[model samples]
Target: MTKINAFTYQPLTIPSHTESVSKQNQKPNAQKSSFSESLEEEYEKLPLKLSKHARERIDERDIHISQTEWNLIHSKMQEAKKMGINDSLVLTKDAALVVNMPNQTVITAMGLEEANTRIFSNINGTIVINH
Candidate 1:
């Protein structure tokens, strides 16, 4: 009968001297560009994400927002984040959205009519889109 151990451990291997030297010699700009490229790729993957509550509200309230409008909202949200706005109220022709700028998430949404009757709190900025 052969006995087997339940766990196995592997020793950590340190980088060879030449490997460390090559890494130290790499251009800083090249490293920065690669990191920035990866960040851009991640940003592109999720331009916007709607929370479950936001989606529910959108469907329940029958709000219609076009893709172009969403793109514009996303760009504006990025600008708002740069300006240190974490929570924002976005007013559009047909709908209103509360967005978390840093996370690029729509927290909730409502029709323009409903939005007009309600008070929005904890919002640092507002973006009004005519289109």
Candidate 2:
């Protein structure tokens, strides 16, 4: 077998001024851009589909009240009591208030002022009302 030198097989280098031409013809980073870019064109169009009714119907749950509603209810209950309604009861979603009648027997038993304080002290929520 005849052996030829490896250097003899290589072609001579051609020094062409192709920098500008090469830069102009450079392809965009197709792989990198496709992964990172937010272009909506590349995605496949979704197929037409039927909308199914939700399996579980939403439960009609009781809604909670805000601080304002609590104050309003409290004021309304007090106003109703001030107008001479005896043993009145206010039933709210989250709270209830009962105003006991000013019985002469109970007044004699527990004293008027102390009983009044105990009756009016039935308040709810962290925020205390001025009235």
lDDT of 2 at 82: 61
Tell me each candidate's TM-score. 0.64, 0.23
lDDT by residue (tens digit), candidate 2, 5-100: 744455556658578666655646655576544422321221111111110110112223344654564465455546664444434444333333
What would the TM-score be for candidate 1 when compared with the true structure?
A: 0.64
For model 2, state the Cα shift of residue 100 in Å: 5.4
lDDT of 2: 0.35
How many collisions per candidate?
Answer: 0, 0
In candidate 2, the residue pairs with backbone N, CA or C atoms under 3 Å apart (3 or more residues apart, or in different chains) clash, namely: none
Total clashes in model 2, counting residue pairs 3 or more apart in sequence or in different chains: 0
For 1-131, candidate 1 gives per-residue lDDT tens digits of 33359666666667678777777778687888898788556445556998879877886898877778888999999888999999999999999999998888999999988888999999999999997
Question: Please, what is the whole-model Cα lDDT of each candidate in the order they appear?
Answer: 0.85, 0.35
Q: Where does the lowest 10-residue lDDT sum fall in candidate 1?
A: 38-47
